[model samples]
Target: MDIFEKVKEIVSEKLHISPERITLESNFKKDFEADSIDLFELVMTMEEAFDVELDDDAVVGIETVADVVHYLQEKM
Candidate 1:
C-alpha cells in the first residue's frame, strides 16, 4: 500500500475507526478526538509499521493525516 493508505490503515486500527472515515485533511485532535496519548500511540505504531524513527519534535507538528504521510514520504 501507498503511504496514505498505510497511514489510514494504521489510524483506523489505532483509533478503532473505519479507514473510509479518514482523509488527508483529517485532524487527529479535532476530527478523531484524539488526545496526546492517542497521538503518541499512533506515532509509535507508525514508527513500527514504517520502520522509521520519529523525534518528539517532529511528531509534535504532525496534526493531520497528510502531515504524517508527508513526513514518512520525506523520511523514506
Candidate 2:
C-alpha cells in the first residue's frame, strides 16, 4: 500500500475508527479527539511500520494525516 493508505490503516487501527473517516485534512486532535498519548502511540507505530525514526521536531509539526504522509515521503 501507499503511504497514505498505510497511514490510514495505522490510524484506523490505533484510533479504532474506520478508514473511510480518515482523510489528508483530518486533524488528529480535532477529528479523532486524540490526546498526547494517542499521538505518541501513533508515532511509535508509524516509526515501526515505516521503519523510520521520527524526530521530536518533525513530529511536533504533524497535525494532519497529510503531514505524516509528507514527512514520510520526504524521509523516504
Candidate 3:
C-alpha cells in the first residue's frame, strides 16, 4: 500500500475509527479527538509498521493525516 493508505490503516486501527473517516485533511486532535497518548501510540505504531524511528521533535508538526504520510514518505 501507499503511504497514505498505510497511515490511514494505522490511524484508523489505533483510534478505532473508520478508515473512511481518515483523510489527508483529517486532524488528529480536532478531527479524531486524539490526546497526547493517542498520538504517541499512533506514532510508535507507525514507527514499528514502517520500520523507521520518529524523533520527538519531528512529531510535533504532525497535526494531520497528510503530515504523517509526508513525514514517513520522507523518512522511508
Candidate 4:
C-alpha cells in the first residue's frame, strides 16, 4: 500500500473508525475524534510502522494524514 493508505490503516485501527471515513483532508481531532492518548499511540505506531525516529517537534506539526505521509516520504 501507499504511504497514505498505510497511515489510514494505522489511524483507522487506533480510532476504531471505518477506513472509508478516513481521507487525506481528515483531521485527527475533528474527523476521527481522537483523544490525546489516541494521538500518542498513533504517533508511536507511525514511528514503528515507518521504522523512523520522530522528534517531538516533528510530532507537533503532524496534524493530518497527509502531513504524516509527507513527513514519512521525506524521511524515507
By TM-score, the best candidate is: 2
Q: Write the per-residue lDDT of candidate 4 for residues 1-76, one digit (tens) a residue.
A: 9999999999999899999988888889888778789989999998899999888898888788888888899998
| Model 1 lDDT tens row, 1-76 | 8999999999999999898889999999999999999999999999999999998899999999999999999999
What is the model-wide C-alpha lDDT for candidate 4?
A: 0.88
Task: Provide the global lDDT of candidate 2 against the true structure.
Answer: 0.97
Per-prediction TM-score = 0.97, 0.98, 0.97, 0.93
Off by over 4 Å in 3: none
In candidate 2, list every pair of residues with a backbone clash: none
Segments of candidate 4 deviating more than 4 angstroms: none
lDDT of 4 at 62: 78
lDDT of each: 0.94, 0.97, 0.94, 0.88
Which pairs of residues have clashing backbones in candidate 4?
Answer: none
Ranking 3 against 4 by lDDT, winner: 3
Q: What CA root-mean-square deviation does each model show from the true structure?
A: 0.6, 0.5, 0.6, 0.9
User: Model 3: which residue pairs collide?
Assistant: none
Per model, how many backbone clashes are there? 0, 0, 0, 0
> So what's the TM-score on candidate 1?
0.97
